[model samples]
Target: MLKVQEIRELIKLVDQSSISEFVYEIDDAKIKLKKNTTVTTVEAKPAVQQVVVEEVAKPKAVEVQAVKQETKVEAVKEEVKKDETIDTSDLHKVTSPMVGTFYQAPSPDSDPYVQVGSKVSNETIVCIVEAMKLFNEIEAEVNGEIVEILVKDGQLVEYGQPLFLVKPE
Candidate 1:
């Protein structure tokens, strides 16, 4: 919807213009006016989808997405078997955000944070990097399929260490 000021501006443009039709747009609102025309058209557009999204439970979605990642990884593995270098050589890498003790799982008994062929988004928890007894969840920064696990489970990792190689989706 256009503001009162915008409608006034449209009117001014219609009056000054020698042409029969004039159109203007600002933000999501579009304005069109015609001179020497009796018929007026007023169309209200439906609500627009916002670009800046606020996701409340992104982490849970990431975790759930991990379930299907294995299948995608399998497909990539087959492709990798065709050409081995294709998996790691040209892949986008995920590095540890901080210096810590790298852990594959929350606990030793649990499954590791992520596995090969895992599909992940920026909200996905790839693994936990423990530092000073604080278990920090490491998230995937890019949406991709995990091609390789760089570090060993329960290995000591340094800051900015390569953790996973991902192929951009």
Candidate 2:
């Protein structure tokens, strides 16, 4: 069994790397680490058992389950089909620079930084992403008019996930 410190270190290592999911097997024990926007989770246990440790940035808890082999195959097919339908050639995407909790406003009572039809320049701060207790201002790197906001306030956002779609000026 891995110690708590070992698991924490593993989570940190995985977060710093580009790999989204990691699995390791040693004898009868297995360890899996998966990274998402609002949480970093590591599950470690005997091959027949399941253990989940989730570190959430917010007060909410999110659960993820392993899929059966059959379902995984079907899910892949659906994902491919979904990807084929999206056309992003002309749209400029404002993507999250890191994994964190996405916030539409600076504070709960404040107005959102931008909305659909809001004009923006390359330096406009369109949203905030909170990661590890730090709130980062995300810029609209392209000069455009906001067409859509892809995520909701307090939503978990993955690194490189699109936060908004913009029609370039």
Candidate 3:
């Protein structure tokens, strides 16, 4: 909806113009501004879907309502097939316990708990999973030699996401 100040400015512009009537339509809403010798009439209808702001400061904010529809892309699927870089077969996977950001080191200044050739035993802290400001030390459930770090530091990981690949000792 336009402000009264903006509506007044519109009335002034219309009064000075040769055009007698001005009609504007967006989505399902419509605005009709009419000028006569005696009086001026402004008619506007409410918008349809989710509100969207189109222009700024002419009215400051123009609210528009629209329903969004998502379209599937075949190109994204093809790109995923091309980016197949890892071979997860013949290795034990260390997956995430919860949805959070993964961190290799206990702190930013410290060295990573595990690397490509790092050896680990059951109960050994291999990484930290930070969720909601709490840092959790993730343990190596099985004794193994680290073969791969599947997730990068500061990457958001989902529950059951593979974080590392280990060759059992």
lDDT of 1 at 159: 82
TM match of model 3 to true structure: 0.50
Off by over 4 Å in 1: 1-89
State the C-alpha lDDT per candidate. Answer: 0.81, 0.87, 0.81
Per-residue lDDT of model 2, residues 26-130, tens digit only: 665677777776755555563565779898775333322334556788999999988875466899999999999999999999999999999999999999999
Per-residue CA lDDT of model 1 for 60-122, tens digit only, reads: 877778867987999889998888555466777788888888888888899876799888897
Which ranges in model 2 have alpha carbons more than 4 Å from their true place?
A: 1-87
Residue pairs clashing, model 3: 57-60
Tens-digit lDDT track of model 3 for 122-155: 8889999999999988988889898889889999
Q: TM-score for every candidate vs. truth? A: 0.48, 0.51, 0.50
Q: Which pairs of residues clash in candidate 1, taking residues 3 or more apart in a chain or in different chains? A: 73-117, 104-112, 104-113
| Deviation in Å, model 2, residue 146 alpha carbon | 0.4
lDDT ranking, best first? 2, 1, 3
